[model samples]
Target: MVVQDRRGGGTVAVAMACGTGLAVGLLTSGCSPDGAAADDQEPAGRAAPAAAEVRDSADALVRAGSAAVRTSMETASGGTRVAIRGTGGYDFATSTGRLRVVLPDPAGRPSGGHQPITEILAPGALFMKNRGAGVPADKWVRVATASLADGNLVTGGATDPLAAAELLRGAREVTYQGEEWLDGVRVRHYRGTTDIGAAAAAASPRTAPALAAAGDGFTTGEVPFDAYLDEAGRLRKVRQWFRFANGAPKGASVTSTTELSGFGTKVAVQLPDERDIYAGKIASPTP
Candidate 1:
């Protein structure tokens, strides 16, 4: 496995860990409200804005800043499904955050996928556990964000609110879908389509190369997305659909839906026990 940082740092190929069937690429990289109101005169106190005010505001919500979010997504390649669900927080102000990945098996089946993986991010370092198979259980691998190749993090089960929002920033068409309730809040729903290449670039430029490498000749045409936002203009939910015109790398399409809540919440991350961390890299496995 080769680990690089976000900057142009040097790359290092180390033993690849197969914990929970996690791909090497993943190691790296890695909505809204509702409304109502009556017509005719004004209805009592301040009623929520009308349907017209629920227009697409993805860009505003994305650029508004960072917040804590709960994420769940699944990627299908060929006929197998890889599901990753976790709770993490991103601070848009600093463009940094942490996530705890609950790994599942290769087929996302009930058996064989329980390895523990945790990622911590600061300004330049991304510290993670179980970089590869056979590595000491007590050690955390550290990789420089600057040195990582493009798109490496993106394919690595990383879910960032700011990055996800970036995909919506360049939407080709954003239309009001209607109203829906999520987590007990009524939110306005909006749908749109955006160029996958451009959206990936905007979300995280570093992941572009990795995405290309992973998809190689695969075509990711316009990606359709649905977003739900509340009256406060905060994002509540986002659903994305990606399909390849020529054909998906896995012979099927991929869809991921992320739900957000507890805006302006604080996410606390603690480093794992130092006694369990191994500073040396594991050797590459024999062919």
Candidate 2:
């Protein structure tokens, strides 16, 4: 009987561990409050593109900066992941967000018929549902962090008005490091960072305190990045290195990708509506 009791306890322990892992995975994978990360993963592909525009020392910073923004905003047909590192150190836990926009075609066909576009964000809320109007598909979309928190961090997912008022602008410079293949295609990589304090401060004074808790102190630090583009001149992959703000990379590579090509082809738009939004659950244990 003693041995049986021990065995039962061990089983229960294992079950608990597995359940906890699943929950953590769901949260860390960038699907916590928003429908951003968990579902709709690109069905893995072969590799990233091999032909991205390389940065030369003589390249103009203005154009380079604009290109960096435009390139980062590039979207794939199935979807693109827009992500950035949060430098404002925080105490509770550092956070980042990945917004997936189901790209709609000019024809405005069924949402499911086109590819999707995805963008990752620093810790905060994303309210594209309201501000997306009249915004060109290629135009860089900016939003505020506070507006993103629909009171229900989980159910409301990620959407808030005024989040886009804060936009990301050109960097001082964009220097290409080299090139490598992700998934399979060859891509050009560049590293850079922009001051988060000013950007966040402009958006809200609480930015500093919130970022401090995340370990990315409110002051300023370089936001490391790796951008990959394919032969067709489309951004294929990007890896950001702000651990708290930008989650750690898989390995040596800052970001990774396995697929490329086509959008608006079998895409679908089924975003959760605002009424379905909420900051916390009815029966909640979240903080």
Candidate 3:
């Protein structure tokens, strides 16, 4: 999907199918209602780490580069609501990853009326299995990484796990909000806000260009962030809320959350065979 950014003066392809609007391809549902509970609870099994420590650990993970992740986003604009969910793994060393996301309709249910879309990012291209109407039933559509720069701004383009981790490293005025259980793993929650430029600057190189493009013409004020870290200091969950000061489309505000597990897990993704992939121009979804 693609949206012409009237404010940004650029045409941006919506990167993931998770949600509509600026941010896409996030797993917004399936979360426990107490996901963002208050931090007033007393010290439980493990003590929470300092804000700096949490940032450092996330930075280290980005530097090391392999983890399984589940990402989601929920957005509301002009009375339209969307929710997206995806699960995949990233390999920072090779700048590659794979993700499968259930694209949401304006009403927040799965769109496409078919299976979830699967995307694989290699060194120079992105391969996708899209089951949307009019797409071939078999074979993958390949897109050059460069064509994704504009779309990637909010989607983070390649793998969201790495970009999400890097975004946490930019948090300022960090406060340890307390402890919580995520998928049964005890984690320390921290809250803070980050400048849009700083967050874009801190993202992994693979997705930074898109971040830069997305921030154009928009007054991206402070973006609130919430991060949860496990005892080993691995990033368990990260959420960012984007609210532009200016140039925001009417009713468009995006919130993205990504959860990580299987840290250090080795994941290998191979590109599809040339005979089995389509490298031609794809017809953009009708506006």
Output the number of the lDDT-best candidate: 3
**Full-model lDDT, candidate 2:** 0.27
In model 1, state the lDDT of residue 281: 44
Q: Which candidate number has the best TM-score?
A: 3
Model 3: residue 205 alpha-carbon error in angstroms: 4.2
Question: Residues 1-287, candidate 3, lDDT per residue (tens digit)?
Answer: 53222223323223333221223422222222335535453344435345566556556676557888787766543334455677898786776788887764433345454367787766545667763434575777665543443324344323356555655555677767877899999987877776546766776666565445545523355557778888777788887775433223332345778777887789888878898776454554444
Residue 278 local lDDT, model 2? 34
What lDDT does each candidate get? Answer: 0.50, 0.27, 0.58
Cα lDDT tens digits for candidate 1, 64-183: 565666665554433334456656776655556677766554334422445546766544445667545556665776655434432223333454455555556456655665667888
Regions more than 4 Å wrong, model 2: 1-145, 148-169, 197-221, 243-266, 273-275, 278-287
Cα RMSD, each candidate: 10.6, 16.5, 7.2
Off by over 4 Å in 1: 1-66, 77-82, 106-113, 121-126, 142-154, 197-218, 243-252, 269-287
Candidate 2 is scored at a TM of 0.33
Each prediction's TM-score versus the true structure: 0.61, 0.33, 0.70
Q: Which ten-residue region of model 3 has the weakest summed lDDT?
A: 25-34
